[model samples]
Target chain A: MQKRYCAIWFRYLLTDWLAIRKPELKDVPFVLAASEKNRIIIKAANQLAEKQGIIPGSTAADAKAVIPDLKVFDFIPGKAEKLLAAIGEWCIRYTPLIAVDAPDGLLLDISGCTHLWGGEKGYLQEILKRLKGKGYYVRGAIADTIGAAWAIARFGKEKAIIEPGGQTEALLKLPPAALRLDTAAVDRLHKLGFYTVQQFIGIKRSALRRRFGEQLLLRIDEALGTAAEHLQWIHPLHPYQERLPCLEPIQTATGIEIAIRNLLETLCNRLKSEGKGLRVAILRCYRVDGKLVGADIATGRPSCSVDHLFKLFALKIASIEPALGIELFTLEAPKVEDLMIDQEILWTPEGCGLESPQLAELLDKLANKIGAKNIQRYLPVESYWPERAYKPSLSLSETTTGKWRAGRPRPSLLLKKPERIEVTSLLPDNPPMLFIYKGEKHIIRKAEDAERIEPEWWLTQSPHRDYYLVEDEQGRRYWVFRSGHYDDADSQWYIHGFFA
Target chain B: MQASKASIIQQLQQKILSWQGFASPAAAETKRMGLGPLEDAFPNGVFPTGAIHEMLCPTREQGAATAGLLSGIVTALMKNGGVCLWISADRRLYPPALLSFNILPEQVIFIDVAREKDVLWAMEEALKCEGLAAVVAEVREVSFAQSRRLQLAVEDSKVTGFLLRTDLKKLTTTTCVARWQITHLPGALPDGLPGVGFPRWQVELLRVRNGNPGSWIFEWNNKGFVPVEEPLAETEQHLTRQVG
Candidate 1:
């Protein structure tokens, strides 16, 4: 058996081909003209205009002579890049090792995988046929070497691969530009009566190297598979992604649950084999009705057990409605970490029952039922004032322990807003003697002074307050305060906060 | 062995007093009854857990601070990883300000909503959550019909819920375990500093399930609240009354 190497080159049209084709300009002459106003250049040209001798890099006015009434559109670089990315993503169906040749092409390494489609020719036909059915015009070529395949895809008469050790004969009729040389080098070769790659091949190797430099000779060598060309494939940072395509659509909850269970089993097995566990899993069900329903669950720690994952999914299954039946199910573990594999000491005998994980799972279920934001965890804020010492968070995921402040005794219940009261007492150094609050008056009976908590000057510029607990003639107690510190001219007593 | 009738009656009274003060070993098994006193009552007793209680405030301003105090009581009870969910349609709770009462922000979850219906829905959901220690829902207007629904929901979940109504007059036909109206009270001043005294509020326990509804004046303290037992002492009675 002969060894075979295959390279699948994919191209993305950066232009809005659909918008251009909608005006019946698909078969009409059109040139994507670039402007010098901001140093932009024409990026692509339609086939009709290319046939009319109006090529890319030609000035807009010059192209107008070849084909008048040429429609012009403003060039948007960002949109073009996004469209290219979408195309690159779509090309993932062909090969996993897809490299973005940016702004317009993809390089795929489909070496051992081509046999799945009965060889490269059949695979190329299937891909082109599907893309054309989706209203796309594509040209593809495959070869033993990436350089030869790339050259043949762009300029060869037929979009077919050049067999192993046959690059010289296969590329003979092609122009020198097919060698993937720079524009200047190709023009230089053309000037030297070397229009065809065959002419270049006929020249003496040493003379070609001495006159045209080693770069040109190296291109020839690379095209003929004599030199090695390495390509880097883009790899996702996190990888436990599995996708299942069902031949029969599943709409019932039971059917979806079964499919989910199968996927979870496969995913957990993969995690165990890798000595890793997932912290977060996202299940995306692509419905045939064109709606995407996604359910995501996060665990406190990395876990690979099917039961654990199923419990989390159970909390969120009600949220996912499999409308119009789901045709594809994809489960991705975007976050994963190494599992803790240490054994507990026999002497200590760690509690092996369901404890923390069970509690966390219960909370997750409640959160899913009553919206995530409704379930909150409180984190203590480091503040001297009673009401300023804590904040509410969505979950216990945020561990901020060092922020807790000790020593001061805070009230169990603090009023949301302090109400103003009429107090009859001297200022600067005294607690209230008699105060009327909420339209009632009571004589002071007994009282105790709590320490004054001054606001942190660095954090906030709030005034100092003297907090005190007092009793009334009616034997009722209240938490009240006098705002401002001594000696400040602007210091005035304002009811700051109340304690329950 | 013959004795006078009066002397025999006196001996019988002494025996009854001893029996009432100290329970016999056999009587101890029969649990003392007669409905324990109110938890806040000085001589009454402490409030029992797993029981429903209520407090009502007549005015908005008076009720606001009292509500905070009630939250403090809830927080103190929730020492064992307990949580309180505050479902409200009217009041806007600022988390930082509530921390002074020693209520951990994590322990109290405030749900601020716009519609009255949503407030009831949130209250029902909070009550259903088993981990929560208690739920306080503030509805501007809760009808008797809606209150029945809430009562049933809370009963089913077996969680304590505090329903604070800004419009006290609107609570016409709902059956609550207790009702209270907190009113502002005059506070005593410290000796010789010449400034306004600390604020005070009178909590009126207007209704109770099996106890007497009476008002108690409590002085809010930094450490905790203390009931004003001697509001009318002889030494400063005239002076305090004049100030009031």
Candidate 2:
């Protein structure tokens, strides 16, 4: 099989995207500018701006003087690459192997895929027509090699498609810049009066490597099919996926449910047989209008239960909108894990602790309803500070490495942040006599001695806290602390928690 | 004639209790649940395990007090190395504090959801899991229908449920087996010591199905609940005066 590659280039990638978003800028001359070395330089310009002698790389001020009504917008960095990648993903409908050519293009390995659209000419036409319909000005070319396809897409003048074995002939007339050479190499070639690639096509490899560097020779060999070009091909889809093509588009929630149930039954059955379970599952619905809507569900632990997984998807089915009906449904489990077989409980009346199937299923339902992050299990950390005493565990089966600190009367309800309270103590070091919190006065009848605790030296630099357990007349206990030493003039008292 | 009439009334009461799904337990099977005389208030003189118990905590202080009392009960329920679920919109029950009531913090799972509806739903789902020893939910409000739903879930699974009602704006009737109110009581050290004493709360049974309602003072001594027989001199006088 002859490996044919296609490259599609966006002439004004950034400006075209901007015009599409704000259609009012369709006819206006505009340039996207960015501050380079503290000077605003145009990064991309529309065709109208280019026709009016305002080009990219010129200062914004200079471009403005040339056309006073020119619209200058801030150029967002990395916007072009993001647009190209998204376009490449959309192109997956045509071919499976797509690589993002950063800055302005995409490369598709359409080796065996072109026959699906009849032939190479039809494939190239279909892509260009669809992309142009989406408000993008695109030019595409097909060739035997990626290098040739890329060069012809951007710089070829005579023809867009190079014949299968005529890459050398195609490269004979194009400029040296068409070979994707750096500016210095191209400038050297132009200084030597070698205006076209045909002038240097017969040069010896060793001589070209010494003068123009290895990149020039390598590009030539890659273009003429003497060297293999490896591309970072994007993985098309997850390995564990099932697709359902609907005879009639699904318009109701019940129809969607049936589709999901059918998909899960197949997927879960395969997973169970493989002794594996899914941790995350996504259901993507392709509508008749070429738009896609998706719903995703995640479990706390690996799950292969069809009923349990269906219940999770059922919660999110209401959020999916099947406008004009869904033509296809695809279920993919991107994350999976080895599942332990069910442990039969023969005699033990009390079930397993956290690893029990029932507990995990219950948590999965809760997590799917709320979110997985909201469901938490905490383990004790060895710390004196109440706020730094515990951390969330990773999973249900995790155990604490350290013992929980006891012998200290910790508050049951600790406030998220300490609240300031107005206090009056009889002496500099004695506990407060009374405190007013939230505009309400409470007389302190009993107070405990202050327990001074210093902040962790490595974590923070702050004042030590002198905590006092004080009881009000109504028998309510509050955990209050003074910010600094009692003698410090700026010391403040804050109520930290409520003790039962 | 009086003896015969009293016996007839006792037999009729037993029949009514049986109708409401409260069967009298065998004498040997009724083990003391460490709640002391508080357990006697129940119909069969046993702390109901397979029922929903609703506790009202109107203020933060009361909420903390209820947390203490609930942890104490949970410790007894989870003595056989079972896990418990704690679901709330925003939980403030410090994990370390559970240590004081003889519970390993790791044995309890906390689910902090944003909406009360999710909290109730999670609570009901957790209650349906027989593997969990108990399920505690801190919800702002639960209607009669919602509470009844939770009660029905526990009826089949036989899992204990504790509904901590933080907001009492609409305290409608529900199918919960009991309603409780726990408030902080002043800590007292023996011989007038200077430090804070063990936790003490005035546990009150505001409502109970086919059971007597009463208030008692109990203290947690790091082992189990110890009912404080006598109140302090001043507060006792104050309480008597208010009652009179």
Candidate 3:
């Protein structure tokens, strides 16, 4: 069997960004116009404007004359590029092998992936249905070559053509502009009575090459798939997935737990079969009543054990509301790696290592049961102030130990915020003599001055602090401090943190 | 050899006697005994696993500190790899106190839902989740039908469930193995201590599966709740001093 290639073109309007910003003008006759010097440049004309006889590059004045009710808007280049990138990201769900065919299109290499959505026709139907649901008018095409697909999507008989092993025949019906040639070459071809690609192809190749140079032949060869063309396909960073389609919609917690276990079993089996372990897996539940609920868990290390994975899920299953009913369950291993499986040696002493996956599972369960933001790993910030020394991380995957800065002695528990204290002591540059905190006055029987640390002047406007380890009259010790230098105004007293 | 054998038998006998009062490491680690002997008489010698322990208190207007006492006990238990699932029906749980109690915000999962019906449903789901150490569910009133469902779910999962009943008037006839009425004790003044005064609670164990119901006063200490034993003896001394 001869090998054949197919290119899928995803065409989007260049001016869809503007349409999104002004949704009211979506179906209206609108033209994107730019002004250069004193002349108006028409960048793009929407389908509604095209039906009103306004074409791209027509002057703003000409478009108004052509259609008296035409809506003209200024063109924004950078904004449109950002919007296209966002659309490109959403398109990644269909195929990981996606490349931005700049300005207005996305090229997806759906060769082996089309089967995932049932086939080429089904895939196209799904894409069209989703885009239309989001209020977009799009055109798609699939052919044996990128050039042929591009031409078909732009100027084919019905705006979408599926040509299999007929790139030459497909291009013959398209206009010279469909070859993606410059405007001058298209006009030159038009003047030479070669209006259609078929006319150009019928002429002698050597004569055409001699007359129009080798560029024309290159374009023709590219459209015909005789020349080499390269497209960069994006590889997703992580790619392990398992999907479960429930015959009966699951509404109860028991039902969801069963589905979770089934999905985890399949996912772990796949991970083990591949000799790989998953580090992160996301469980997405599509509720039948239209709500979407997702639970994510990250292992400290790569793991493929079904029992361990289900334990992590057990901690999080309570947070997932089965809502009306869950119709589908999907588990995706977005992160994976080859794990080192160690064999136990008899009579050999094994060193204890932290079970990272267990810790990560614990954290994941807590985050799910409580809330994602509520459970965070504290990373030490490079600051001397106790309150500013630690920062919370959203995921436990971030290493919590090495990130801390050395040099400062940190308390195990730091107060969320500093408490103010009433201090009356005669100390110009030393520790306080008396202080009252939590409505109890404590006389300092003995005190030792530790260190006076100043804030980072370049980053913050906070004042310097003089810290003290003071023993109260009752024998209990406290860590207190006075804010700001004595020379600076508003040198007040505050109890910043506690050590227990 | 004969003397050694005799000593070994004596040690075995001692070990067997101690085993009668032996507590699981999980129980010891969670500070279960610190909450006083009244709770220790029940099954498991503490809050029985695989059963629903209900805490009833009047409305917030009536100064119910049920959540505070429950939080303290739950926080102590959380140290032993046990998670606390807090299910709230109407009121929002304060986050600051939950953090201070050493219950990592992530450890206390709060389900802020509407309607008592949904709260009961969520509670049943939480109780059935294995590996969870305990579940604290707050509801206005748990109907007899709902309580039966919860009892079955707890028994199946073998996880402890605390049903915090805010409505003290509408008591369900369905037995929940054990029920406690929690009331706030009067705050104490600082007694020459630099730190804040200790918290207190007056607890009345109204029901037990196979034990007698009684009331007790507990002082919240650094470790956990300590029983105020010999309350009459201490009160008599005060009365004599007042008469003198």
Candidate number of the best DockQ: 2
Model 2 stretches with alpha carbons more than 4 Å out: A1-238, B1-11, B25-31, B231-244
Candidates, DockQ: 0.12, 0.52, 0.03
TM-score, one value per model: 0.53, 0.68, 0.46
Q: What CAPRI-style quality would you assign to candidate 2?
A: medium
When just chain B is superposed on the true chain B, each candidate scores a TM-score of 0.71, 0.91, 0.75
lDDT by residue (tens digit), candidate 1, B1-244: 3567777875675466456542222432222111222253321233433234445554444555666567556656555556667776555454543555556665565565557777776776556544456778876666667667766766655567777777666567565656766655656665675323444555667776444677665655544566666456632753465488
lDDT string, candidate 2, A1-500, tens digits: 88899999999999999999999999999999999999999999999999998888999999989899999999999999878877888899999899988888899999899889988889999999999998888999999999999999998988888888988899888999989888999999999999999999898888888989889999998999999999997765447899999999999999999999999999999999888999999999999999999999988788899999998899899999999999999999999999878778777656348778888888888777777788788888878888999999758887766888876688889999999999998998888999999999989978788888887999998889999998987779899999998788888999998887
lDDT by residue (A218-285, candidate 3, tens digit) is 88887788887777765544457888999999888888889989988887888888888887889999
For TM-score, the strongest prediction is 2
Off by over 4 Å in 3: A1-202, A205-259, A271-304, A315-355, A397-430, A434-441, A450-464, A483-500, B1-244
Predicted candidate 1 versus true structure: per-residue lDDT over A1-500, tens digit per residue: 34344433333263335444575766666656567775445556666666677666667777776668876655555665566456656767777776655555556677677778897778878876876666555667777777777777777786476666776787888998888788888888888888898887978999988877888888888888788877666553446998889998888888878888899999999999999988889999999899999798877567888986886787677778887889999999989999866465556322112123433554454444455665555677777766666666765546576455655433323456666777887655666778877678857666676568788888788877777766665544556777676567765444443333
Indicate whether candidate 1 or candidate 3 has the larger DockQ.
1
Error of 1 at B132 (Å): 7.8
